[model samples]
Target: MSNEYLYIKVDKNSMAKNKVVYLEDIAKLYSTDTDKINILKKQVVLTIKDNKPIKCVFSILKIIEIIHSIYPDVQVINLGESDFIIQYQPKKERQILKYLKIVMVSLIIFFGSAFAIMTFNEDASVEEVFKKIYELIMGSEKEGGTILEISYSIGIPIGIIVFYNHFSKVKLSNDPTPLKVQMRVYEEELDKTLIANASREDKIIDVD
Candidate 1:
């Protein structure tokens, strides 16, 4: 085994049969450049203890804790695993920053969209248009909102909320939301880019 790679078998059957499973076998599946296998040989054990079989399950946090104790630079990736691959992750601390960045981006999108709509309404003189329509309907100068203005004011937001499917949280029509579809496309592209970059970097390291 190499320090660059560690294999762990997440035995669902073993977990079901035996309430407690030692990490010894998982630890033996990898060795460092120094040919040491005892590094994590007796380090950790996963135990459901007295928990019911149906409710008891493997904990990712415990597995990660065991792995991190042995290999700080590596991360476990489940590969539809009888055995799982451990890959190099450059900066573990950066995971927190990644989540923070997502939250910031979400806030920006929410507020920025609201601001953009307001700016567009102002630029297009939407209020003036509504006022004119109100006067035409009432057959006099517009003092307050007419029936058209009231109906439109209520209808526009409702239309937007329904069209986006956010009000009911279910699609009324067959079509998926443009935003959700675009997000999926972006996620796929990002995954491809990351994989390509990782492969390129590995090749470069191999050449060196």
Candidate 2:
């Protein structure tokens, strides 16, 4: 295996489901020799013993060193990111806590959005504008629960649904929802930040 080549492709970020993360969990490995590929896949990349959220960045050079320890002259090819972040989040089986969290977030989002909408409407004087339009249209004073109010109430939810492009597991299109897009952007940004900090702080695992 002196002249053999091993190819590795690693993502910028990965999530470890188990406490022990293997090479195959964070990266894709390939080699002409099936035996080498099989063994390489099981190589321990990292171990998580702490029962808390752990974020660490790893350099590809460390992986090369691991392979070199096994096959000294094997050429290692990296086709992915030079540095990648592995985040380990330990799972807890607290059903009540999970439901409580869900309820709290639901309440916060519900009330927060309602407050924002109300403030916007007040600032814009939506009711006054609606009443003016109603007077001009019907030649009379507008009462509560008029067609304008009913349509406004009905249209708000529909508009929100269309704008968000998602509702209760229902997808309006094949494109990703706005929330998912924002979350993805946030994850990528966070990974970059962690990787940069690791490099600057000299905490990233890399070979000499």
Candidate 3:
């Protein structure tokens, strides 16, 4: 390879679908030398052991050193994060386990939300309020089944749909749901925490 510069753009976080990770898996190459780029793409970068999922942080400094050692004449330019994380996970997970987890989480959410709503209603004396409203409008005492109670029951779910901006697979708008936004924030924080802890855990890949 002639003495030339190669530009690589990498994100702060990347996913490796399999145990083995390559240069192409984490970084985008920008160079005129297709052959050299191909060679670099095939280079072994990281491998997960025991067929287990893992996340590891790596510094681009060591990567640059490695590239320079291989092609001393070629300069490597970094156009992305100085350090990044590669999360290794298998593409195919156990279907039964996956479904089981989903079911379990769904059940928990259902029960938990039901409990919260019930507790709130009890605290606010919703039954007494409904009875008074019923008496005031109908000029009589309210029994168990009334339009007020029915409407309140229906309105709870509708309010949830409007507040959450989601129901089943349907979306009320283009904006992401509150749950999705929170999950994304959680994932971003997790990635940052993992990257920050890598060096302390002696799991950071860097120049020796």
Candidate 4:
């Protein structure tokens, strides 16, 4: 079927009580992306009777699944008594840009925290603290490499690496990485917000 045919709105008053519309047909109406079209094609058709969806033939959950595959932010709102509305509010994410943002934020947090720690260390500036530590370990007289100085320099970076789990992506112990935990919490909050905001149409109807 032509892409245009998918979008042709069916008049609620004219639609037969037992009319059947394929899920593929509905998916096509909303999305022109080839990948999404292929996904929709595999779904079963939806049957409408007296304008109410005939249960057992296709569940609301299934309908939600198909819709989310295309428009993650869109919602299906039941207006009751066979009346319904498709609430479309598309959310777009640029993968490359998102990753870049995460990297930038991480770097800022890492450096900012490091600077703060250094600043609070007995009122010593970061550069002065480093120089003093080096002088104490290596001795002011002998400028050559000392075991303590080398170890201290290497250990600082190593400690940071281990704490951040930069290379391994594995936690030092059973406890989750702070970044992972934060991301998970953010995702949970976002999901809760979406669920809470999903039925705006229903809320409006009730208020009226």
Residue 35, model 4: lDDT of: 68
lDDT of 1 by residue, 1-208 (tens): 3336555545322222344455653333543443423555555454444544332223334565666766776545433222222222222458889899989998998898779978988999988988887677767787765776678668878888777766565676777777789987986565455445545555211211
Provide the TM-score for each candidate, comma-separated: 0.43, 0.93, 0.86, 0.36
Off by over 4 Å in 4: 1-41, 44-107, 123-152, 168-176, 199-208
Alpha carbon lDDT of each predicted model: 0.55, 0.91, 0.86, 0.49
For residue 7, what is the lDDT in candidate 4?
27
RMSD of each: 13.9, 1.8, 2.6, 14.7
lDDT of 1 at 174: 70
Report the number of backbone clashes for model 4.
0
Q: 106-156, model 3: which lDDT tens digit per residue?
A: 999999999999999999999999999889989999767998888999999
User: Which of the predicted structures, 1 or 3, would earn the higher lDDT when compared with the native?
Assistant: 3
Please list all clashing residue pairs in model 3, or write none if there are none.
Answer: none
Residue 39 lDDT (model 4): 64
Give candidate 4's root-mean-square deviation (CA, Å): 14.7
Error of 4 at 140 (Å): 12
Clashing pairs in 2: none
The candidate scoring highest on lDDT is 2
- Distance from true position, residue 117, model 3, in Å? 0.9
Identify the leading candidate in terms of TM-score: 2
Superposition TM-score, candidate 1 onto the true structure: 0.43
